[model samples]
Target: MKYQDSLEQASEKAAQVKVFLQRAGLAAHPVNYAVCYDYISGHHAALCTAIEHKLSAKTPFDDFIMADLYSRYLTPANPQQEQLLQDASGIVSRLTGYTDLAAEQVADYLQQLDFSLLQLQQQQQNGENILSAVEQLRQQTQEFRSGQYQLQQQLEQANQQSHQLRHELEQLKLQRQLDPLTGLYNRSAMQHQLELWFTEQPGRRVAAIAIDLDHFSRFNQDYGSAIGDVILSKVARKISSYVQSSGLPVRAGGEEFLILLPDVDLRSASEIAEQVRRGVEKLRFVSARSKKALPKVTISLGVSLYQHSENWYQFLARTTDVLTLAKQRGRNQVASETMLALPA
Candidate 1:
């Protein structure tokens, strides 16, 4: 799909997500939308899978789940932010110290002024000169101004430090949303997108395709962990390319993936899943040390279209179950809910 088309699709998905949340009586906060959006977008495999499980079992969509999702995907680096806030807090403490010092100085000067006033009264009663009393009062006034000047200087320094730290904190939060390993968005970013999609366009259709590698454990056993990793990277690249710009590719876990295609139908989505299966089967990974071709790899996929009456969790769980069925009936096949259904 064209870049513009891709952008439009995301917008539509976010709107649909919002509607889904509203219908289900879930909170529609950005954090909630973010978690749902990421799941719907297929950015956070584990998160989407968890949500799917909840829906499949007709579990309650409670606040605890939402809070967990919010912290994981939407606000993963709060501790870092908290650390910066702590630094700001230190500045506040220092500012308070400066304030206290100024207060003490002011209080001392007031006492001195009171003494000066008493001295002037004595001078008047005894008919003596009052010049010393006036001089003392002037000195106290100058001392107070000097104290204020020092406090203002400290305040400016504190403000500058707080401002710089806030800017750095923002940058860290933005970078946290992207997964460094896969280059796709992390769970948090996907969650953000999901919320945005449903909040704006809740009626659009969504489809999920779950893919899991067959015999992945055998590869790890035969060639060591390093070789297994190579296979995973290659397979992930293939799946990502097959889905391309039109869909979201997620590395759900070891040897498992999910592709989310919004506004897509079962037939078309199944074809895409089948294509990925074939492409993976064709991949040839060579052992660097032995200079020999390694064992062949295959995948099983399950596809399911969204049903409005069903919760997001349920919709994904149904898709995952279908994928599991593909593995059971011999691996390396594409299966879906429609394919496993009984005739009317």
Candidate 2:
């Protein structure tokens, strides 16, 4: 009878251990079977001791074994089995001084974990958005730099073209103002200069000297107009050279010249006119038709100074009057209104 009772008790313990292992999600196979068997044996010993104490009307041994189990593993239980053991401890400690509820604490702890997970998700999303914005900004900056570089290159090219065009325009202007035959100031250029000078303030002295080649029509008749043109060119060259070495000269008309002297009195202009007259009297040119030496070329000069009351047209007329007087007098001498008015 004793052996049969022991077998029955071992079978009951094995069945309870199997149920516990199933609930705990532990294997009850050959690998963990020894541990399960040992636990069941200990539980059976405690239960037998409790039954004996109950029969004797004494302190229950089952309570003592339960207190020991709680002390060993319930207070700070295994992390994987904490929820299961905590639930069981609430039921068992109901008859004891254990009013602290583990279920509510577990619920609160799970709520905190959920809130933390939400915050982590939001932070990750914000980081991704910031990275996208930075990439867009980098692309825009690169495009702006490319546009700026192209604009700078275009501006430099435009500036270079503008400079070259301005230089060409200046050269063209110089060519227009120069006489091709004698390299002197042309009639249009001299008129422009005269207009510019006359527009200034009053009492600024200005003199005009008119020069005519002596008997130029007869000379052109003797030789052809071609040789006459050569003589005229040589005469222009000589007059231009003399004026550049002395004063300013302009090719005012055919075989007629004008000199403008700024800041000069009538007496000084007359002296310069006389100098040009003597200079031309010394010049000689060869005739193109006969290939023979020609006589010396002579010029008649007329000089007049601007008055405060005179306009540009009137001043030019007075110089023409003086040239007519010089031509009527001899045709190879310098004459001025002031010189002609003096007593002989």
Best by lDDT: 1
Q: How would you encode candidate 2's per-residue C-alpha lDDT over 79-178 as one tens digit per residue?
A: 5345444544543454232223334444554565566556556767777444544454456556556655665565566556556655655665665566
Q: Where in model 2 is the C-alpha error above 4 Å? A: 1-129, 244-247, 287-290, 339-344
Candidate 1 lDDT by residue in tens digits, 102-180: 7898888888888889999999999998888798789888988888898899888888987887788777766665444
Worst 10 residues of 2 by lDDT: 59-68
Q: Give candidate 1's error at residue 174 in angstroms.
A: 5.5
Poorest stretch of ten by lDDT in candidate 1? 178-187
Give the clashing pairs for model 2. none
TM-score of each: 0.55, 0.58
